[model samples]
Target: MTYKLHKLLPAGAAVVAFATMMTNAAADQIVKIGHVGPLTGGSAHLGKDNENGARLAIEEINAKGLTINGQKVTLQLDAQDDAADPRTATQVAQKLVDDKVVAVVGHLNSGASIPASKIYSDAGIVQISPSSTNPAYTRQGFKTTYRVVATDAQQGPALADYAAKGLNVKSVAIVDDSTAYGQGLANEFEKTAKSLGLKVLSHDATNDKAVDFRAILTKIKGENPDAIMYGGMDATGGPFAKQAKQLGLRAKVLAGDGVCTESLAQLAGAAADNVVCSQAGMALEKMAGGAAFSAKYQKRFGHPIEFDAPFTYDAVYIVVDAMKRANSTDAAKILAQIPGTNYNGVIGTTAFDAKGDLQHGVISLYNYKAGKKTLLDVVKM
Candidate 1:
């Protein structure tokens, strides 16, 4: 009986010690990262692209067993749909804050991002927009707001310069969707085009959700301009270009990053060939990590990376990098570390200026040929 008692005592202690070790390891933190975009609207394709980027980053981080401050950490993505509506964006922002997300990587459109920035600022959360290009987003004095792409102030002039020098456009007509993004970009383009001696024939406004642009196009046709700039997404820009073709207007179509997507050819059909657009970053073919990232993105998402997926992908890595530098997952600590980010990413080196905008932003011009977006030139600003 004494021999049996001694053997059982050792075995029980061994089991207790193993269980305690597991308990300690299980205490590792779960860091929540929020992503927002228009998941159920005309822009859903772009939204999904952004979400896929964030998801890929989260999966990679968790699979590698991320460690912060000596604690095994897991990254969780809490994705939300803002419907591309400003009001919806604020509601979604509040939900993410309530859910305790340490950082955010979205609100793809400036119209939605501007309002949501306030909510993130109030909650002391970090927001790094992948595609929002309005200068107002980061110019609002919110240290919590940042973006990976160039603003309209940069992209607008780049496009105008391309049209003036590359396309040699003499007179131009401008049309905007009236959203914050469309109008802001158009305003900037108009200013630059006028400065470059391009005649400003007419400026028109259309709704973001509008289908028929015939009335506006008819008015623009009367102007007989060499180029017509449409400030909107591919959804509208595609049809606008197609309708312009059907109307027998000889003027070429010009647009900003909103209209620059792989799907533009599919949406605009043959008219896409006559369209020229500008993106707020380097072309995917020119990105240092573009080929590998594109292959992985396709294998995982079963689709190609759209407009700003690379930017969002890099945004996730930037946030994680901030966490590593701060040695903490607390939202406040992560926020504090974002401004100091200097990580080299797939998009390029991502470091923010004092206003939380990417300091070394690039603008790439593109044209479509044989149903593909062809890169023209990348202008570093």
Candidate 2:
């Protein structure tokens, strides 16, 4: 009976040890990261691309395991749809703050990012935009706001330079969708175009939701400008180019990063050949890890990237890098470390200026040939 009791005691001790281990494993802390973008509107494809990039990064980080402040951590992605609307963006921003997200990876559009930044700023959480390009976004004096892509200020000049020097256009007509992003980019482009000694024939405004551009195009057709600059997303820019072509308007169509996308060819069809656009970042194929990322992205999402995925992917990793540097998962601690970040990731080295804009921004100019987007030049700013 004594021998049996000793044997049972050892077994019970082992069970107790196993239970303690299980409890420790179950106690792993969860860290939630918010990702916001237009998941149901005209920019849904681009938004999903950004979300998938962050999702892939979060999945990879979790697979490898994360330990901060001596605590094992499991990362979570809290993705929200802003629908590309400014008001919706603010509502979602407050939602993320209330949900206690440690960090946020987006608000893909400049219009969305600008208003949503205040919400994040008030909550003391970090908000990093993967694609927002309006200069006003970073200029609002919010330390919590950051963006991975170049601003419209840089992208606008690059496009205008291409028009003046590359295309050698003498006169240009400009049209904006009137949203913060669209109008801001057009204003910048117009400023630069004028500085370059190009005659500005006309500058027009149209709402982003407008479908028919014939009225605007017809008005511009009479001007017979050498080029037409469109400040809007691919959803509108694609159709605008198509209509211009149908009207027999032979002017080259110039656009900013909003209209530069993989789906632009599909949207604009044969008219895509007549469009020249600028992207706020390096071409995907030209990025340091672009080929590998493209292969992995294709395998994971079963589609080609539209635009901005690589930037979002890099943004997620940058947030994790901050966490590791601070040695803590606390939002405030992570935020403090972001200003000093110099991360080299899938989008090359990323560092921010005083306003949280990319220190070294690259603009890639592209045109479509045979229904494929082709890179024309890369301008470093």
Candidate 3:
């Protein structure tokens, strides 16, 4: 996967510039942060969004003389790409550990975040993810792991409920990308759909690079389900939606945050029209502080990174707020400071639940119509 780098630096410079800043900041009074995500591999777009979001925020904070303990402080980020793989994610975490960052914001996909989280937690680092939505990640009892997005339990089941109860669907088939985010969400939807007495007739798995899903759709069509639910992101889900339509599967397709991106509409084209996708957090252009953040991102990156870049922008600021409140850069101090954070983030008013899950009771249901995503409803979590 190719990365869409921010315009703050020359192209192909995200890792070098960010790592150098993290290293050089020791000479200056800086609140150093590390952002880990897939800068390459199939999930590169998400990683780039995560990395750029932090860089943009930290740059602004430093320029504005943001301070801690009455002393103006510079903010820096050590951006590392995990390649969206577990082993690679662990390596990224180690890179941050080597840099000794004050806090972290990253690992876009839930799979990478889960294993990489143990590294941060054991080392007494505060990690706040901007977009991971798996429930098990938070349920693992890690005090330092936090996320701004609602969990798959919240997003996946709600989508399933809507397909079964709200949309008046009787039966559904499901597909996953064999990723933690994908499989985990598929499981939640399957369980919930069963609880609601909706028939879950078929379930299958694919991967990020899969370009052909006609076989899966064909198998699903055999079940004659009213809808087909997918547990994956736009990289794969977008193509899946398109393939399903091309295969003559007319059943509505429903998906979770993993696939709720503006890019999906383009990937699926006319086939995306009427396909439902749900996700946590308000869209980048719809949330508070959206226009400003969007303009800033576009100005810095020459293009938009992803739909939820502002949430990452907010994630870095949230940690910065904690650093100021704690009056120290100690990881423990910042970790403890996270819970009561009612930061006026670009996404919305963000506060953490007892489990370190962002009280983002804000989940939106969206449908692609006429090449645009139409917001159907906002279900407050």
Candidate 4:
């Protein structure tokens, strides 16, 4: 609910850690972990939050002086900027592979992560994504790919159920950015919403780069749907929301994890208030390391933490801990240890199922209230 930041120690410490990683590789050692995300693009803010969360975990684990396999090892986090672009993500991942990281923490968006994941898997590296919810990632049968957050298949339906039951909306319009994550979620929502007896008015699509939504909004308005659901990240989401409102569609807007970031609120302005969004993890207001991480993040970055930060933070720990538990950083060993993991994460108990899915995970609905996306409620499955 609140945030505070401690004064940052000089960047010299990280420089020293990087030095240690370059020269030393023995006992009293540092375990280098690489995390990649769109650190400089339209979704850059979300990527920074994801990286910060991972850094916070590394700092905490190092503070604990965690002893694993009878070695006093420290955690060292190496972050890469993927720019939210698929090709750039692959390049960042290749750099991480060359570094020979004990494990990899991310490729935040599905579009970027999917291709980068192929690189990691081919390199025999274990990768855990906090935000890449596209089902195709796990279905690929690559033992190295795992997801910390629940899949879009789960998130889409939870929002669909809310739109049908709580909002009592009969006609719903669907829109998506056509990215792997966006299209996957939009498809799931459309299927589930229609199965729930709601009328599917108009199904439209957009790209992350396209700005003008007047035509789609006009069509949706003509359809007179009770609500509009968007399947995209905040970058496109904020504009879509603002445009929808500006075009006088007025139908309640709903979206999945992609649109749950704070930047969306800035884009939609007052229009953001009426939009209902669903996210894959617990709200920063209520989670295992929620408050502490938020405070630390604000101190370091001078801003509030985004919604997906906890999962990213926990994912870092999960990869490191699993590697340590496996006794060897062999990709197969680390990958095998992920299933049925029960580590206490910043988001609470972290566990994965046989299908490489989080077991009994939770999803939450957020309403932008008082200039914030407060946790309206949670839906778990």
- The RMSD of every model to the true structure, in order and in angstroms, is 3.2, 3.5, 10.8, 10.7
Q: How close is candidate 3 to the true structure, as a TM-score?
A: 0.89
User: Model 3, range 1-381, lDDT digits (tens) per residue?
Assistant: 134434544744868888888777644576679988887766677678778888899888877877566565777788888888989889889889878898889878889999999999999898898888888888889898888888888887788878876789998998999989899999988999999999889888988678888888888878888899998888888888888888888789999887887788788888888589898777655677888888888999999757667778889989988988899777789888998899987888888888889766667889987878778877777
Error of 4 at 363 (Å): 1.0
Clashing pairs in 4: 5-299, 38-84
Candidates 2 and 3 compared by lDDT, better number: 2
| C-alpha RMSD of candidate 4 | 10.7
Alpha-carbon error at 75 in model 1, in Å?
0.4
Overall lDDT per candidate, in order of appearance: 0.94, 0.94, 0.83, 0.83
Worst 10 residues of 1 by lDDT: 22-31
* The 10-residue segment with the lowest total lDDT in model 2: 21-30
By TM-score, the better pick of 2 and 3 is 2
Clashes of 2: 0
Error of 4 at 348 (Å): 1.4
- What TM-score number comes out for model 2? 0.94
Tens digits of lDDT, candidate 1, 141-239: 898999999999999999999999999999999999999999999999999999999999999999899889999999888899999999999889999
Q: Where is model 3 more than 4 Å wrong at Cα?
A: 1-27
